[model samples]
Target: MKKLFILSLLVLASCSPKELTEQERWEKHAENTEIIRDDFGVPHIYGKTDADAVFGLLYAQAEDDFNRVERNYIWAIGRLAEVEGEKSLYSDLRARLYMTEDEAKENFEKSPEWLQKLCVAFADGLNYYLETHPEVKPKLITHFEPWMTMYFSEGSIGGDIERVSTRKIKDFYEPNNQLAVSQGLIRTSDNEPRGSNGFAIAGSKTKSGNAMLLINPHTSFFFRGEVHMVSEEGLNAYGAVTWGQFFVYQGFNEKTGWMHTSTGTDIIDEFEETIVKDGSKTSYKYGDEIRPMDSIEVSLKYKSGDDFKEKSFMTYRTHHGPITHANGDKWVTTALMWSPVKALEQSFTRTKKSNHKEFYEMMDIRTNSSNNTVYADADGTIAYYHGNFIPKRDVAFDYTKPVDGSNPKTDWQGLHALEDNILVLNPPNGWIQNCNSTPFTSALEYSPKKEEYPAYMHSFPENYRGIHAIPLLTEATDLTLDSLIDLAYDPYLPGAEVLITGLLEAAKVAPVETNVAKEAIELLKKWDFKVSESSVGMTLAQFYINTYYRSGKIPNMVGNKRISRLGRFEYMSKTASPTERLAIFQQSLEQLKEDFGSWKTAWGEFNRYQRNDGEIEQDFDDAKPSIPVGMASSSWGALASFGTRFGKDTKRQYGTSGNSFVAVVEFGDKVKAKSMLAGGQSGDVNSPHFSDQSQRYADKQFKDVAFYREDVLKRAKSTYHPGEKNK
Candidate 1:
């Protein structure tokens, strides 16, 4: 009997489950998570917990374009120079100047328990992906760390950190070659405008009597991926996620939606410090005392002729901020938002908010430094927050220029309360829009008064995109999701209207030369300023505008304030001589003929969409098959912005940026939304989804978003766990 009992006890011991190891725990989490790839290759991640959802989210992101996922982290964590060589050393230095690996880890350690779990899931997801797919190769980051998320907290592409000039950082730290750092970085009209257009309409203006929101972000192609993440912990959000980020940057839930536009509000400022150098110690002058400047040593590695080389720099900082560069004889400290933990918290918590009040409280976190938020809810509320991280600076100093660090009054006096910032909540016009323009013109007459706010609070001038959106929104009534898409993708170029009238006046007075120039002028004369696939006028107008802006003769300012691209267009149209206009038109004609065989080539023939491979910096070939894109650049106020690029060997320009991820959402009892990506979801050339949406994108055809569980299951193309072979 004892022998039989011993044998039975041994059998019971073998049947009992053993405790899981850390890796096994991760595997269990993966098992608990499910990712459903919809027809469009957008991942809909469902998990038992929020952390599990995040884990599956990252794994799915890696499956789509691991190159971008790894690349973002490599760049974010100050390791790009290790792969890209000496050119990126300053970029690495700039990253290190703000936060070190230890600092990031410390920040992660200090975060709330829930946030830490999310961070852990972020790392585990990417690391598990690498483990499961041994065939995949990472450029630099083979093992992602939880702390690494600290460096890339907010979702705006590159965020405010990118605004800091790496060129200036190099000039200050590199071997002695003195050059004065310019106080103002005047962004000219020639550079492709890297801002987004956001619109929110109240139920009063919508057909379904539900608030409508347009999530139109003008970014570089493939900059962000469209995704839907859901968890049992009341987390269900659909939107675009910047590569490697765990949270959705732009998108909506059943009850609320949010869109972010790059804000021109002066969130970043510079302080000129009076340096007092003595022996090995350095001090800087402040108010009534000399304060010691903090010096930190940073060493960066760069690829050098198949080998790695190291460079060390002794970076300095003051109470104002890190010394980014030198201006004249003064060391300049750049002050911007740097609350990584709070920023990430706000970014994630924002996705879970169900109502405007919850979202409003979330905004109080105030770490969204570089974006202006356009928000809407199911309750028919439409609101706009111009800038969240506005610092309360004394009105006596011009914050636009570098101010004296010695003056205590010049320092930022904490952040402005939410009410103090430029805010529009349910304007009387029933519509709100911000296209990186002045908040004063956001909602027509209903916009916040400019005179009421401090100059630093809303310094941006009215842009072409803002001018284009206002009238359309003003006249809008009973807007449906489809009609909202139509309004967002409006082909009429208001910017072209401002410039073409001047060209017509010039043609009347200027000396007539070639018949080609006469034909171009006549095409401009009778035509409405609307862009289309077959519009030869659009081709000619775009070419003329590009040529004029490239000419560098556009006035930089009117009165004292710096002008925008639209302002530059207005300046050139009114001020340029008839001969100058005619000459520029001739130049445009000659250039057009040189590129496209004839100057009469249609806009679509010249502007194209092509994705030959999955490379981040795509190579353009004129011989390669490409889709015709009817859209024009935002620089010309074409709201359906499509910025294109040309190669040295190619004639036709291929799209590279603008309107990358677009979605129109209507919030009712259940969310109804339609979205379009620039190309498709997968970055692998072999995947069926690589260029699946390219044609649809050119046609401005958006697909329905499967937001509900039943809807997701209906359209699901493939479903699997994170490490499962079926994926």
Candidate 2:
């Protein structure tokens, strides 16, 4: 038996391609690419061709954080269950529902020759990294294939497919199960708002007469790495690339810059399918005809104990899409845009666009389904696209919820044209800003009129950040890169102005006032509605607002029905009872005293920025040394958002998300930019690059980006090929 097993292993080894060894292939690729590490440890990759640039980009990504690269792919390709166990099985199923392994491979085969080359290079780059670094062990994927790139084509952290509910999937798949209501799911208007801020200023508003862009992505810390990729084939792009992705998700070329903010457009929709079963056959009603539903068996592997286990599920799909779950008695299927090949092409092509015309032509692809784009070019053109891939639906059926799948009238009537979609091009105000807000207010008088667009196009509420940004951009005349950076990090918390003033009024009207409450009110009264590390007023305001949310002092605003943060503040200020307002303030004061030994604690003492390790989901410790971060959450209207989440026993609020990668770019005859990452490029704790920029990030101090090769070499700390070790 041992001899037979050895012979089988030998046969398997011999069956592998023998044209060139994996090591030799890696050496060849390394020769085609060179990676220059700057003083701050950002990789500036130079390659002979576009494919070679992608290869070098992936190779550099692996060196910086192979763990994240592997983890992202593991989750993307529906193999997360094999590593995380049974609880993640639904997530895997959700991925497979939209695109199966066979489909991904087919998609790869159907890609254009140029894109195919990039795909092959992507796999080759990562595979070479794994082959050369024998010490780095991948949890699941040992060898990457070209097809795997299809699963994670676009750069958004969670793509449109993530809108499907895993809990609903579990309810439908499991036997004799009651549907579970998803609790604690974060919504757009949640206390910690998760999104990006993009500001595009044309030449008219800038001091240097050059269009400027603010690329501030509010994602979890270390979610993306900052890199500069250059190729002889005109692939010179610099900015943030999501870990494991070859393309720069948010960045700029020589003449243009683009930033993406999550759009509130109704793109993903659920359809209530009328399912019918006859004996062993199942069909769904479509119009007046009955169409047989597609059924497939999906086998999943999960880690159990010391061994691997398997679970097989029979999945069903309808014409609308995959039957994700049941809505009451009706089977519900989710419909979302899933054009991986085109999406990948559009994502990669956008980085190379030189001007507004080229960028506008790229938007014709219409595969960017989940984001609103803010664009600026060296030609002094600034634009804002509300949403790219909007499907035209019948006005009779509301797309915000599940529509009737049986009625063909409810189906999407192809995609809307780029011109039809809500777009702002060179608004007379010379600026465009989108903080995940309605496009109607993107610019002052020149903004797109809400009444002119379809009702489905502008359902998102106007946020406090939008309200806060309008005045600043409207009054601005001479803006520079440094001034734009300062504007992005402005400390004024507009939401607090309404809520704090209400508290002051409540204090004056209090029938029974405690000395501590009066002192707190006095501090609030003197506050300028701005946040700073040492501001005691900010500390009080944060606690008071948080306590209001937790104590249920106000009515719960459920889902889309929820009002804007500014509206909520208005309600508290104008409608809430004076007694309730004072009571909420009292609770915050007491909690502050209990947590930090005093109610007069500074905001810096409670709000902190700490990074103890490189773990994807970090653990925070109050005892560990951490820097004080002055920025507050976007919920409170802080443009430079620094949101926090606390551990079970931790006292200080440690920042977990917000302001991950921030860049200010000035597009002139030569593109000049400054960027800062949350921590640094490398994720290894032992690597000096891991936490080198943590203090600078907290201070809002950005490092000048090295876009040109000459600048990169000037700041180069070490330069080498992929396989070579840097000293």
Candidate 3:
């Protein structure tokens, strides 16, 4: 048996094929250009035209995180297995299932002209960087097509980015049983979600009397922040850019600004496969003849040391979407087509748009993935809209999951007419806010009527935030920056009016123990149904609730009257009695004392966004306090697990992931406005400006960005290209 095994291994090794060397891929993308690295490392491209700025942007991003960005696109092309091995097999198939090369190409053509220019410019920018920087080796990809941007579309990364979705998740090793998940018809549990918070106090509402936009987007540290790209051709904006992306997907220029928060609305769906007939060689099925089962095999490359393997996978689908998961204990397939490329084009052009008419035209495209975008500008205009390219199905099938391919009724009836599904022009309230909540609650009394739309539209994330935002916005007769700030930081809703009124009643009955539960009960009792930072009860209340909140528990809806009635708002029924609540509080205090050797601790002490580089020495004291920067906790309370840390010195749990790039834009009032990027102005360590903003960022501070030529000239440390650096 051992001899036979050895022989089998020998034969396998002999049959294995060699994969491309890292150098080989690098050679394919090599280009040349003059690069000047300013002392701060913010590249100042001197290209002959707009494309130069793009090329410079790509090269600069490559310098910082080429590996991660390249990997991002590798997965986009449905070739993740080439680099990640067996673990990525399903992800590749999922990509192919949802999106295709031909589909992407076709969609690219359909994309708007300005959007295509930016993409093409982006490709040129990358090509320029490669030409100038032959020393940098591309791990897998050396060339990028215009449509490659579609593969790495901002939505594709939810497979990894801010929010994790159920759409493309791989079956983790264990099969035959369901893996644990935050299951729901609608997930309204984004209190600790990954998001950003922004509010515009229009000239009508602000002391400045100039429209003020708080362009704050919460994403990962060291992740992409705002980049000011300028071309005499009238291209300039502020917002997040993932490495090589040519334009800001979410942000503001002078005339208007925008913010995007994820929505649970089903923008993508999957369909099951049916067999009408089997043919020799290649198989073709009927679409109406018997309801066709669209299937395609995704071929992937896998490298195992000296050898490479090709992986072929079958993805099945109907007209609606791809069949991602297994169907009836058999292999199934799904098709995906978000056409985000169209949206990307819209975003690129809209950023430069000078008026609302153009903004409305851009909004008409509605090719965006699952997020609601809120807009504000100097024109005294503020708005929010939802529903991006939803597939109009047969209306008889469930769009939430895999539909039957055998049933002809499951076929999509083209896309919904943009106007039929467009939910905008919300009125009454002058502003709109979305903390990853339902789009219907975007504004106050003026929000879109639920009855006006169909049930198929994603009506929720019927979350506490939106529930909280509504009363907060409506109840205020007069709105201001101060009021907006207070609302963004508001604590939980009122106990008296909430679903757990019964739980509070129950809390009154439990056997009492320590002050921990007592304090929690006391806060809950006196709670004003608000999250204001100064609320005396809110601090203790949030802490206590944090302890009681479990991730996987079904929601408590009975006491949810203060908010919208949701599917699983029943968790309130499980609330502890006052005595029991007191016990929890006392236990918490005691645990903290034991853990830190003292109970006296500030909220900042526990929750920190600690940057753990693994190089910082372990200190037992206030040694590694996470650099405090960005918005406060509970303000943009998303992705609850993210928090500031005290590092090893003062160990404690805290959350952070908001306002990485915060700007206070007073439109037209000043050429330069207040802005800040977390960490520092320089991404490179060699520069003295590295992390210059860390201290200010920790303090929620701002710096004046160079909006004019003189301002940039005064502060501009160094300028360079992405290619070969010429000192």
What C-alpha lDDT do the candidate models reach, one value each? 0.89, 0.87, 0.54
Give the range of the ten consecutive residues with the poorest summed lDDT in model 2.
181-190
Please identify which of the two predictions, 2 or 3, would achieve the higher TM-score against the true structure: 2
In terms of lDDT, the poorest run of 10 residues in model 3 is 181-190
Better of 1 and 3 by lDDT: 1
**Candidate order, TM-score descending:** 2, 1, 3
What lDDT tens digits, residue by residue, belong to model 1 across residues 1-727?
9999999999999999996665986887898899999999999999999999999999999999999898888888998888777777888888899998888999999999999999999999999999999999898888889999999999987888888998888788884735333221211112468889999999989888999999999988998999999999999999999989999999998899999998877899999999998998999999999999999999899888989999889999898889999998899999999999999999999999989999999999999999999999998899999989998899999888999999999999999999788899999889999888888989888889988888887766887888889999999999999999999999998888889998889888988689999888887887799999999999888889889879988878778967766677776688899899989989999999998889989988988999999887788888889999999899888898888778658878788889899999999988899999989998999998999999999999999999998999899889999899654
Clashes of 1: 0
Span of ten consecutive residues with least summed lDDT in model 1 = 181-190
- Looking at model 1, residue 681 earns an lDDT score of 93
Over 4 Å off, model 2: 1-24, 175-191, 558-560
**lDDT, candidate 2, at 358:** 90
Clashing pairs in 1: none
Error of 2 at 620 (Å): 0.7
* Clash pairs detected, candidate 2: none
lDDT by residue (46-84, candidate 3, tens digit) is 343444456556656666556545665775676666665
